[model samples]
Target: MAVYTKRDFSVNLKSHGGILILALIAVFHLWIQVTGLQYTTAAKTGWIIGMTPVFMALLGLAVFKESLTLIKTSGILVAFFGLILLISHGDLSSIDLISNKGDFLILGSSFTWAVYSIVNKKISLNYPPMMTILFLFLMMGIIISPFTINDASIQSVIHLTFKGWIAILFLGILCSGAAYVMWAQALKEMESTKVGAFLYFEPFVTVIAARIVLNERITLLMILAGIIITLGVVLVNVNLKKIVLYKKSKKDM
Candidate 1:
């Protein structure tokens, strides 16, 4: 896609920074996420990964001096609580992370992704989105090549079924390629905190997808949690001044 887009391959100091950010993004978003999932339940992974928005908000305020409005802070807390409810299924005791290696790894990934999003918001504007994502996939392949170039990896790929190939293609194309391009474009257009808020929907989408794909049963609690997540996202994106002025205008009418 990057090649087809036909952007110039210019190199500069700022371009180097873009490359470094893309490398970090590739490592945390792809490598750490995949590794952490190996050690944790999908539900737990979803919940842990869902914390990226909260981390982004906190890190933005701390590192970048970004403002944390009341609405945004409340939304982060509400969305985080909703994630816990969704993943725990009303049993809060099961939300243990200290003993689980996978949980820690995923937690680290979540934090790194927040850092990446905040940093990338400024850096991504320097290059074309598709080109940056193209370099990102390249960096991921290079990082994994040492581990995946062995005979076992080769044999595994050789033995992969047609369905497995299709799945791999889907992940490579849609999940990594297209998703990163869209994320980059979003960061260019909106605040990183706002863009991160949309990530809260990931687990909500996962739940619905699981019901359809894995035949997993969705309970009423999960539905309620989804609603809460949606509400929190709305709050994060709402314009308080606009709402106040609109309300005053209506009163005057």
Candidate 2:
């Protein structure tokens, strides 16, 4: 996530709210991994996770008095359509899209993340962002401890390799804990949509990460999809005046 600051531009969002965010994310990841192993298809999982922002935006408007601008709403819709395209492509009849328990877990994860985002906006006004994050993580750590593996024979129940262990740990520490804190701190300073816009990048990042990790081929369709998504992101964030000026400059050239 990118940082936005009105006053102190050098403030570190990561140092403040990242850990708590990460803990919540870690829980989500754990749940998804467990559920996905027993399930198939990615549609249900995506729909569950994907619905959160709309929910969160509603929460913000209802509870926090944050207005949803038309432009912002359009951006959200465009991003979602892009996500659908990227995830489903042209497969309209794939039952695999609706077959996973991971879908419910992902939905739950989004709900928790929504709670975190709303609470963060409220509490950041009263407390240090980092302190709030620290306490949240501590609370999560306690809550999640019960789910941790305690028995030896249970290993056979959920088979995991060394790489999987590493993945889980990294997800917890870096993506969950650290990224959450960074994002929270950024939320304190930036407009919500500005911070939220970074999520559009996540699909791209995942594709790239997957390609690197899985040796997946990057096809022409994927490249075109990326270009369309990039254009959508620009439309969502770029200033209209700047866009006009750029067009004029191109015409002059």
Candidate 3:
């Protein structure tokens, strides 16, 4: 691409091959999310997806030998509880009321996403983040196109309204393309475990977006759920030793 498109590069084919493997894992994560959504409620899916950070923290320890401190572990557990609150809408009974194949699939997707993040971080150590993401987007687009490329879809694209086309362009360009590139860049700079905490906020973001776009009401439970989720994420990122020492000192008082 650098040769024909007038771009610059020093990366070799072997390096690109490594990026491609990482991209494929990312593609698999995306595929799983889509497939899982079909079998579950969006709320359930979002809740399950929120578990990715926890899974990423664990995978970072298991796969990359990343540091797993007491604080980080506690943070993960706290984040998890917060996730439960968000998912269950603060009703303990609601969790048991909702369990199905889709929930399981979403869990699988979370696992895969963690894997993808850890692997991407590993690979980014060698390659440029932007270039790697570009390659990933290109490859994933090619792989995914076949699934959507049918006679009915072909006809539908031509009939899409101006607003629909704009939305598609925005998603393809800003969300999928730019957002992915930025995420890749972020993963390159941070520990995958630390980065995973960001997933906890996703449901909250979804809720806010829903309120604006879908005109959904934000109840007290939703606000509490958001607070718990944020607290959990904060705990996951907080220094465990500091927290312990602080508690001990206050007890001495």
Q: List runs of model 2 lying over 4 Å from the truth.
A: 1-30, 33-59, 95-97, 100-112, 153-169, 217-253
Clashes of each: 0, 8, 1
For model 1, residues 208-230, the per-residue Cα lDDT tens digits are: 67667766666788677766755
Worst 10 residues of 1 by lDDT: 40-49
Per-model TM-score, in order, reads 0.82, 0.61, 0.77
Candidate 1: segments with Cα more than 4 A from true spot: 39-48, 98-108, 246-253
RMSD of 3: 4.8
Give the C-alpha miss distance for residue 45 in model 1, angstroms. 4.7
Whose TM-score is higher: candidate 1's or candidate 2's?
A: 1
Arrange candidates by lDDT, descending. 1, 3, 2
The numbered model that scores best in lDDT is: 1
Instruction: List candidate 3 stretches off by more than 4 Å.
Output: 1-6, 9-11, 35-48, 88-105, 198-201, 240-253
TM-score of 2: 0.61
Error of 3 at 116 (Å): 1.6
Q: What is the lDDT of residue 173 in candidate 2?
A: 78
Query: Per-model C-alpha lDDT, please?
Result: 0.74, 0.58, 0.72
